[model samples]
Target: MIFPLTVDRVFADRTRAEIGRSVLTVPAPDGTHVVLGGHDSTGPEDGYPIGVYATPAGEGRAPGLADDLPAVGWLRTARPLRAAAFHPVLPLLVLGTGSYDGGYFFEGALVLLDLASGRRRDLFADDCLREVRSLQWLDAHTLRLLLAPHDDWEDRAARSEGHLVDLTRSDWRAVPARSLRPEDLCGPRVPALLPQPTPPFATPDPESPRPGHIRSLTELPDGDILLTADHALLERWSAAGDRRWSLPADPRLSGGPLAAVAADGASAWVEARGDWRRESGTFIRIALTDGTERERHTTPGPAGLLVSSGIPLLVPVPAGYGELSRSLFRHGRHAVFRDTPRAACTCDCPWDDDEECACACACPLCAGDSMDDEEVWLTVVEADPAADPTRLAFPGTERRRQICPWSWEPGETHYDGPGVWIGETDLVMATVRYDGAVRVPKQGFVTRRPIGEDPSGTPRWVFPVDRTATALDIDPSTDTVLVALSDGELIALDATTGTLRARGHVHVHGVPVIPTALTVTGPGRLLLGTSDGRVLTCRPGPG
Candidate 1:
């Protein structure tokens, strides 16, 4: 049975229709507010036409392009500006460019404009920084920059470096930085946000390596553990604690069977994800007898976030703007000529999401941008294993679907709710619980409810946990519910009563690991993957 969901409560923090845009604050040097309005559609292709203009602050005048608006000193560049600000004490302006148009994998650069003299200095130092994601003018002569690489590049590791630019000498130097695996230095989105923040103007050890921890783990009926690795590999461990089988070790993909797994008596359905270089992924029917691929089903590549339960494969459908942004990025990478809108939705809500962006203006720039013509909805996609996942659905509304609160909320430093999991006949949802503007810490809850004939009602029960659960499993034989928290803790609870049973930590290959995912793989076992690239198994106790 399919049950519908709704938003229990809503809180929004917004000023103007700001979504994919930034507000530039310039001193104006004369008390007037200097506004360099960002174009909702500007990027690498169309370029950024950043101009400085002074507007009296607190005026009711909405920000936009008007014929009467005066341009003081303007800087035109083919690169999109990620951040820009005028120097507080000097006649200089600083702009930062991110990895737009698939530029992150290679390098990112910075630009400095002498507003008074109109002299521009383009800087690309250290040969690193695929994108300068964040920038701030530390002083009249010092600029601080945060640098990062793309999400799925070279190794399983991610690096963050800080740069201090000397405006006086027109040079830059490295500063104290933190280099860790990409998983730990994550941003609000998948594949991690470029330019993870680091301490500015100071020196920290730059050597960092975020080891490939476990990605996904599930227990088999025979008490075996089936796990995936961040390096895109899969393995099976028998009940006797021996390596049963492993997939072809592809160093490039370093992927695991992350989407979902459906195990039958003698066979299993596994999501065989490939590298981003491909346009599709394959679903393999593996024989439990020897762990060989028996049957194969091919679906679109970048099926990066997949969740399945044998019958239907569920994918997290990016709301309209996200889809378009991703599409543009992909096209930009492939030189596909998106021919889409250059302006983006300034309101946090996508322009097409009328409910959220009721005040969104359908301006000429937006109209001319080809992508602005269509609407994208937030909904769960039901993909057929026999066909490509090209369809989406909404149970309650036409344009929007029920959303997980923690997923897209603005204040969320950590984003959860990536997929919809259907474990056996029970639906498991691990989400955060809030109290007003203050989020109740470690109060994340795991709500489970068996799919009943009624199709609509309250959950079976909701139990609180220490952090947002990364994985949930229901052990039918023992009637146990296993939840994995982000901090790598596993909590066992009674499925029927939702009472605390037992809690413990998981270790893989003798090292304590941060649990990435979990599943009840066998009769008396729970399987979990950690952040350090190991698949470990555990036996929980009854509390």
Candidate 2:
């Protein structure tokens, strides 16, 4: 008997309004109720407007305007609201607003709103209020807001500047002082920002671009902080606002905005995205010492690339390619195939002695006695440092040797994942089963043998558990294998004896998590990154 499974569809209706800006829900003073920011409708048209909304105690949804709620209050603003941000721990909201006519700015002001009393207090104001880019709460009383100079006439009369305001002392200060110019903050020369003509998703829309968009900023092990931009510019800054050093992007690869950044030690692993068709998308390894660079061309349409102990692994998503073509480079440079001979030779010809047959020999090992011409051409290329690189350049000349004999029929699905170098001679490959017609439980089969061996050798399969595996990482110290599954579970397999060593469920904040990226930090520490932007460090337990 066969069983079929189906998924459910659910949808919710959301009201559309032009008055309300993007508002974030926050906890109120009572701790049970929630306070919503007032809508900010400030722009070139009318002055910025502000309104507040609230939710009932213990309720999840926001209360309607007609509902009677004692915990809710609204405050009027003097000018149109430009931008607003909620405090991390306090019931305070910071708002910015201004007025402009024909690109000429008039009055610009920053206000602080107290949710408990519905009272509005002025924070700061200037003649050149352009717009607020971002607002973040640094501490209980300290707030960081990014302000752009107004692009209006009245504001043009005054000097344009970016200011940082301190709500605790009610004071404003210029950002980066007078040393750095605004043009320096602007983005470098970039390719045309035109969207793909037929993007895989929806049509692209032009949004106001932030010139100096900060990418990843993480606190180091020490008190210092590391910051990176979209253009692969890494900067280390001291806690006291001191610039240490700035590393430039690689000019050869035309390294554009970075896609991801991971740090192991003093070195940082940066994956920058470039135009592949234009010979731009290349992965580079940068040494923080003197900004030395090494680059490698990876698989096309690579989703991400990870480095484990200096070994780079390319993760490419299958897109628009057939099944056979999709498995081309899933594992690595070397791919194994199970081949069979077409017929047996009766006569002991001289050509068959050296494992080579003439063009008209018609032996199964030669060109003619095969069932299918396409299947007869299966050849595997093994990387040999000692082999002449020039001889290996020909399509099928130097590496036209077979390793395994074709005895049994090939499996419908191919196994492709991490390549494990078990010892100096043995190289084991992990394979998984994937079928589009029927749902089959995923399993791992190991193909192990000595390097540079003939195709006559057989490979053995090793199954750790019943779960479907997505990725495999081998521990060099213990020879234990870490397998990441589709169900968000990680299992450890002992490669030497083919036994299950350990298993554990990965979670973040008590909720089950699916790891989007996984890397072995050390022999025992495994770094897991989830789709929800959470990272967890897991160490192996005692046997």
Candidate 3:
């Protein structure tokens, strides 16, 4: 379903605004309206009711406005809904909420509602259920819900849990097969800390809260669930609520709560939010494994990661906008393979003292940056098949460095855009320059070096695409590069010869489209995500 505006974008200005409290107006059949109440961040005394509002057609939109008329609709309360999940088969809306005391510490609930008639039924309202952060429909009647205990709860009580609720069950006892916890699922135990003493005979202070609840949950192809917690921890949970793997934060790597999680068959990708002043963040990847330990792969940002058709892509958010900016990274595989950094010399004067500069330092693989340049490097590590236990190895062979020659400026003058992989060998990237008032296209180039290469020398090829190519992807079988322009046109280019192969305009339902995300499903199938949150899948004919 597509909305006129995204939830994030609509409430962009309100950071403290409860994402769950934002009411979503979904149009009902027969041109009537139903108000899907969001989670209430305000205290329970505030009476943020979780219910469905049925309003007459002329009263307002299907997701009717709360301020319409007095007698326009009836309020049906389930539990102050924290999240709503639609059953894959039945026309039911699953509502989630947590317990809340006067000051936000509250256990949540999961309620099932018939969307058509507003008939509500409390599926589970136990005090044992914590905040229902996320819910996914596993099948027709089976639903997976991510739960975290109330805020004021002790660390020992704050275990992450997942419950499989069977909607078809008659008895509530039969609905929940078992409660799955992190410790029960994974082998290694996460470190637990006792509350530190405050001062000499000081009054007992309140407990520090855990990071925000799971920011998002995604299902992997292998049935492993990816849970991104409030504290920037990305844990892999089994369908049975066992923790399969978890990624620890590296000090050198900036971290934040995971904004989103996406996985292809091979690896899972996480988009981590960072400080706005930093102007960058980490896009981490971890292999799907059976242990609680995991490895990390770093990428450039301000960026986000998405997996489509088993290929991982990085979507870069332009500088200055922080989380609000949206731009698509096309040709991500090429960026990973081609623009990775190789060994370099980092002496103050490489030319002045050649012998002193002989020591290996950070240098650009495809393009060399001087010692003074603020550079970002991409390092790609591949699995070594010949190694014992099949461990990942940095071959030192496939590395490329890209030089953003303009990052040294005081204000926001550096150009940033998503990089794409074209064909098998080229890295395509688009960058924009803001000249005070107007933002103009700076340049888009394709890298020439292979995945593993030294970047201290000149690049092999640098072809520029005139218009800003926000999204790019190569076809599954062909060497054609699919480019999504800011103007809503999808163009296919021959990566080998830099020739245009095909072109098509994007449309959703019937409106012109601006794609926020693009993925090549197959040789000709393309999936496009728009700014309005509508996903369009289409097949483009060859030129």
Per model, state how many residue pairs clash: 32, 21, 29
All candidates' lDDT scores? 0.44, 0.41, 0.42
Q: Model 3 Cα RMSD, Å?
A: 20.4
Tens digits of per-residue lDDT, candidate 2, 1-543, equal 000101111000011111113243444344444433323432211222234455554665555433433334444444544456666665666665544444444345566676656566664433233344445676665666555543534543233344444333333222221232233233222221111112111111233111122333334556444444433345455544454664544443332222223333545545454433222124555554444444344434333343222233333322112111111212234533332223333334555334656656544444434354333222344434443321211123353345443221254444344445565445555555545533334554544545455453344445534444444556677777666654556666666665666666553222343443344545665555332223345565421
TM-score of every prediction relative to native: 0.39, 0.37, 0.36
2 against 3, candidate with superior TM-score: 2
Q: State in Å the error of residue 39, model 2.
A: 24
Native-referenced Cα lDDT, model 2:
0.41
Off by over 4 Å in 3: 1-269, 277-425, 428-438, 441-467, 476-478, 541-543
Question: How far is 114's C-alpha from truth in model 3 (Å)?
Answer: 43
What TM-score does model 3 achieve against the real structure?
A: 0.36
Give the number of colliding residue pairs in candidate 2: 21
lDDT of 3 at 153: 47
Which has the higher lDDT value, candidate number 1 or candidate number 2? Answer: 1
The stretch of ten residues in a row with the least summed lDDT in candidate 2 is 1-10
Models ranked on TM-score: 1, 2, 3
